[model samples]
Target chain A: MNDIYLDNNATTKCDPLVVEAMLPFFTEQFGNPSSLHSFGNKVGLALKNARKSVQKLIGAEHDSEIIFTSCGSESDSTAIMSALKAQPNRTEIITTVVEHPAVLNLCEYLETEGYTIHKLKVDGKGNLDMDEYKSLLSDNVAIVSVMWANNETGTIFPVEEMAELADEAGVVFHTDAVQAVGKLPIDLENSAIHMLSISGHKLHAPKGVGVLYLKRGVRFRPLLRGGHQERGRRAGTENVASIVGLGVAAELALQNMEHENTVVKAMRDRLQEGILAAVPNAFVTGNPDNRLPNTANIAFEYIEGEAILLLMNKMGIAASSGSACTSGSLEPSHVMKAMGIPYTAAHGTVRFSLSRYNTMEEVERVIEAVPPIVAKLRKLSPYWGESGPVENPEQAFAPVYA
Target chain B: MWDYSETVKEHFYNPKNAGAIEEANAVGDVGSISCGDALRLTLKVEPETEIILDAGFQTFGCGSAIASSSALTEMVKGKTLDEALKISNQDIADFLDGLPPEKMHCSVMGREALQAAVANYRGEEWVDDHEEGALVCKCFAIDEVMIRDTIRENNLSSVQDVTNYTKAGGGCSSCHEGIENILMEEMQARGETFMPGAIQKKKAKPAAQPLVTLETPEPAAAPAAGGMSAFQRYKKIEEVIEKVRPNLQADRGDCELLDIDGKNIYVSLVGACSGCQMAAMTVGGIQQKMIEALGEFVKIIPVDKAQYAAQLAQKQATASA
Candidate 1:
């Protein structure tokens, strides 16, 4: 009955356990982690345990590989820049078209700074073209930064395969796992990924803290030069509380991985399935089976996403779209556009990212509430009148049913 | 967001008089569904006296379009042609308590529909024969009389000039030409067109001097009865710009005095400033600093990229001097 949050992709509520882990560092254990005092040692120990938890979550071989930064963006920036700095002799970087702006924008800046950039494309369902991705990797390419999951579509990428290809090409591989971590299982030991970025806020931890998992024996350079914190890799006073929260959340996520994969995926499937059954023209976006279990992106033809979002807000449901951001901009979603989704359907797309806390009752509520709203909006849409509301319940049910 | 007024939203959701008449004597159609907004107005006219018997509309657009059409229907339901002809865009906006300035064109559209309907009822041939007489904003097909009445009622003096005028450039951007034509015509009618466009360009450009002394008369006091609220400051700026227009024309220089903040009035130095070295001095020192000092609510911003070019010209002139 309370506001149903479907925008888990944007951010998540901090879990109570994570909050409890963070409480002491804010006051009782508020010592400069670097200072030579018992107080500092006590907090320093907490930081170590947090790092260990993060390391264990990703199955990293060493705790030293877990480097903490302010957020996912900073982690991504550090990874890309540090790789290029370590290999200054190389001037080329390869990445995919569907990367987050944190990587894409930085890549744009790098291109302007004389770095040759290669962007791989995605298919109509937002799956990256691995054949093209393989061809683009070469000796001159110093770094490869691809997202483990597309933020808008929740399409999981072949990071392991890509990492293997990059390794053969002598390139440093990095995946922005901001949307993938916790939602999917990640085992660095079994994967060729040399570096991966994860943010606290995407899971159930507070913002302003993130982790960059850099494999041992990897050469890198630090972005900022000041303190000895983060093993001389990053030089800033630690966000002790948020870091603690992120560690606790990561540990909890590791513990819940199995249950979440099944339970959360079921809820996602139920909601996506129900909407397609009720609404006339609803279709899920991205690779239907390969996507994150908690994400469901659907396009209800003929209605604008902002209008749907507004109406959903009235009904206490929160969802997002790629369209509203595109209207005033020439740059549509690099992910959607690369997939060649027609502009009409691209603008009407809505993304629903669920969290583990979401329940079947909430899924049922959404199934009950969403169709009529879509029907109402369709009445006001010019597109709907032209197509005539996709009549015949059999025709409406055929895609999902068949 | 379009900065929509509450009135616009209300009428959009619960339009007062929607739908069409079964046997309508006259109909007015404005805009298209694909153009972002449209209104189809229908009215039954009493043939003997040419008074509207009933009025209704169906609009496909934003809240402002729906509201404007709804207000138009209400305004002309039982009025004669002359009375309805006098219904300006502002009257519809006022009827709905007010629309955002950019959306004033929606009201203009509504008025256009009513006028077109009445014109159609009175014989479209008659209205067409008096093309110049009707005084239309050729771009949006808005009439001259409505613009004059809007200015008088709104105490407007400038063409940045638009607020709540319908049928003007709201979408698709093609109607902008007509709006500009209407604006020039309005200025000409007010005897404000001393030397427009190339006429001023034909005058020889004066070489820039170090001490470019400007003679600006203190702006005339605005009509106090209209209230000196910050909202009305734009009208006062309009008056000041008009007074300064003649001097700018005679000097063969193009300058725009923009009201950035109600308190700051900025005069951008153009022409020679286009290539002047003192462009920053003109923008920061002369324009911005001066404008901010003018009114408590005013802040001036100079868009002149040619400030340095003007300074270089002035420096050359000073060396010659």
Candidate 2:
């Protein structure tokens, strides 16, 4: 039984190269970067090189612009809070409704703290409403935070153009690029995005390391204030080993960028097309042309996502669902709801996020395993058969059950 | 991932009695697609004996929910209508070994469907009295009566417990305060006080028990004497601090215990908590929690940094003398 992991959007397996690069930092290079001794200076230089590697991956102008934090959520918090604190008189924020909980939850907390939050709505294809977004931007708005690409549906938002709009209004624009940093080409040095957040684990790096890129001359305030670490922008001792791993992962991501665009995209499309062709009443959720190269969210009607995922798990194929039951909420994914997906289809949406490690053979295995599972679950569904009273179980049951 | 029991996995993977019964005397359907779980239960009854001749169910839900409906059907087969009505949600869960607390609502759905089916069999209107109660959790459309009954039936004690039993405050959490209010009212009506932070304290106690017992004489013996030892008091104070630390940390603040003299606890507020306007609330809430967990005489004093430094100096001076 082969184990096929397709839930890369949640987290990916760490690359061996990244782990090999980090091994020495845990034992041989154990000195704190803050110390004045030679041992510390050696570790400090390695940290500098790691920053440069990440800077090159994202096309940042200076290595000093990258502030390392604990994870993506911390970077997001720092960027949004710093923007708001820098402009105290501006008590309004503009964001979209389909943002990950890291941004949406903070926006909700800020709303209670007397900041007016304007949640831009999305269309049926999960595209942001640019007109509504533009109308909400003004002198009173302090910051505009949005994701570069959604984690669930893989819909890419126009952060580059939106940042330009924000800059014209003198507002700080930030993007949670956790999903887009490694998969897509980013040229932040030429873009107007004032701040961006990236997580290490989303790529092949280990967890517990993240980067917050602040363009030079951007007003900033630290979320954690104590030691003068990360140039007083973030306060915590460096997660030395994880940071080194992230740097190596960034370099690897840059090297494989083209392969990701072509091969991984092809495998993702194969899985999506095969599932759609085999199953009836199945369709992709996001915009096909503008989505991330490694994602495909397909909805199978008249069934639930959790059941589909469990049956797929039986086949050793791991995936994620946008169903409300799976999320521990009674409503489906906010991304699906924002797109106005009907209840029947939204309850049955499954997300298949590929990675550079995925192969065509693994994709083919998943494609072959999904149709029978969907058919079996739908056979048990009361809503599945042609629009009338269900047939008698006595007639439908096989001899073994009868 | 959910820690589903083996029984639940078995029932979900190879569910029994999954199809609809033809010429069924009674059919009951509950839940909607939007609610994330729904069930349709059908029963073939032996009219002369008033016993359920057979049962079948079709469920659209997660593994635990589907398993729960399947378990309900097996439990009710061959039982009289009255006997089947006595099959509570807990019985269904117990039949499946047990369910994660969050998935207990799936068992509740199964029980509700059973009641609806029984009502249909008796030719009686299944009155949804839930609509009469004020809507408490707007996200799940759960009303106050449903929360109250589940609380009473299960002896639930906290907002999280209520959520696990009824799924009332699980989404958005805008209605958590309302759920808390209902829980307090229910507890009070039953002549019990629902301490605000008791549930979390209870959850933490088991993990800390071995260490506490190893150091102290015995925590079990403290309640008998109304006066706790210094070590026991220290352990309790640490527990209280751990309980409030996350709330403080979320606001980028922290707290530390400076000293404890008898019933009074001196604490220092650090980070963002030092000059916060809600410093009083933070201190008062900690004091309330200590009093609730320890005893009524417990008090907390928020000592400033200068005062703490002076007290330390005075202690050193006394030691030298």
Evaluated with TM-score, which candidate comes out highest? 2
Error of 2 at A261 (Å): 0.4
Q: Supply candidate 2's per-residue lDDT for A375.
A: 82
Q: Which consecutive 10 residues in model 1 chain A have the weakest lDDT in total?
A: A393-402
Which lDDT tens digits does candidate 1 get at residues B1-321? Answer: 444567766765566767677678887665432223445677898888878888878553445666788788888878887888888776787788776544555686787777667766767731322222242333334455666566556644444344233323423344444445566666677766523353222323234333533853234432222235444656665665555445444424455763343334556656534333224433443332233323332444555446744765897799799
The TM-score between candidate 2 and the true structure equals 0.78
Tens digits of per-residue lDDT, candidate 1, A53-112, equal 998888888999999999999999999999899888989998888789999989987986
In model 2, the Cα lDDT at residue B120 comes to 89
lDDT of 2: 0.85
TM-score of 1: 0.65
Q: Candidate 1: misplaced stretches above 4 Å?
A: A325-332, A386-402, B1-288, B291-321
Question: Please, what is the whole-model Cα lDDT of each candidate in the order they appear?
Answer: 0.72, 0.85
Model 2: per-residue Cα lDDT over B85-157, one tens digit each: 9887767877898777567778878888888888889998675443446667765558788898899998888
